[model samples]
Target: MTQLIFINLPVADLNRSIAFYEAVGATKNPMFSDDTAACMVLSDVIHVMLLTHDKWRTFTDRAIPDAHASAQMLLCLSRDSRDAVDAVVAQAGAAGGTADPNKPQDYGFMYGRSYADPDGHIWETMWMDPAAVAAGPEAFAAHELTPV
Candidate 1:
């Protein structure tokens, strides 16, 4: 069987978080959803579980970090094209999320933008030309070395 990935996140407000994810294009999977948690399907292989604080606590003993104050992780999704990346970020912005708290990144062959959900969890949308990526390490060497 193919391995699937499930990214679980702690949310302060369940309904609001579900609405925000739905706005960003994820559909809720009722089989894995309930009052305290929601399973948002990003793709066939990728699912995001939005859990309320109480539900989240059941999974781990560690304290949940305040996403607004510190980034626990940056969830990234790839798009078919640069425009798609921009569009998703725009959608996120219109859905009561913050667009590009960090500057949008453009590396000629690749581009990306980010958004912060209502709970301050960061999500980044990116696009890269496969041909450019296949051109090898030299294509990104310069950008990697430059201090952003």
Candidate 2:
């Protein structure tokens, strides 16, 4: 079977969290979801499991940190173009998330933007030229991409 990644997050409100994820392009996987947890599919290999505090405690005893006041881990999702990155971030904001929690990044060959979910989880959307990536970081270090 192909390797997959499931990012589990503790959410304050289950239904609202589900709506937030769907607005950002993920689809709910009912098979793995329940009243206390939801499985959101981002891609074939990427899934997000949103769990309530009570349910989260069943997995571990770690205290649920306030994501709004503390930084957990930054999560990034790649997009096909700069516009796509912008679109996702915009969609997130329209759906009640905070857009541009951090400054946008534009390096000629790449672009990125970020948003914070209602629960304060930060998700970054980025786009990089495929050819530039194939050429490797060494190539980029040699010279900056010419502005298009």
Candidate 3:
């Protein structure tokens, strides 16, 4: 079988998170979803498990990062077009999420915008063309850039 990723994130409230994700167009995977968690289908190979804090603590001994105070993880979604990226960001904001008020980036090959989930988890919506990206870092710009 091919490798598939299941990213588990702890949330303070399950239903609220589920609503936010659904608003952003992610459908739930009923096979792994239940009262304690909701499986958000990002793609066929990618599933996001939104677990309640108590349920998530059962899986690990490490301290869960307070999402607003420190970074636990950043989720990125790639859209087929620039407009799709913008649309998702807009939907997120209208659904109680907040889009990062930053300028749009034009790398000649790729573009990206960022948003934060209701729980303060960072998510980036981006678009990229492989042919342009293959020209090397310098092909688009002299420096590699990362979100701040």
Give the per-residue lDDT of model 3 (tens digit) for 33-97. Answer: 99999999888888889999989999998887877777766678789988898999999899888
For model 3 the TM-score comes to 0.86
lDDT of 1: 0.91
State the lDDT at 44 in candidate 2. 100
CA shift of 46, model 3, Å: 0.9
Best by TM-score: 2
Per-residue accuracy of model 2 over 1-148 as CA lDDT, tens digit each = 9999999999999999999999999999999999999999999999999999999999998899999999889999999999899899999999999999988888777888899999999998899889889999875796564432
Rank all candidate structures by their TM-score, best first, as comma-separated numbers: 2, 1, 3
Q: Give the lDDT ranking, best first.
A: 2, 1, 3
The weakest ten consecutive residues by lDDT in model 3 span: 139-148
Alpha-carbon lDDT of model 3: 0.83
TM-score of each: 0.93, 0.94, 0.86
State in Å the error of residue 2, model 3. Answer: 2.2
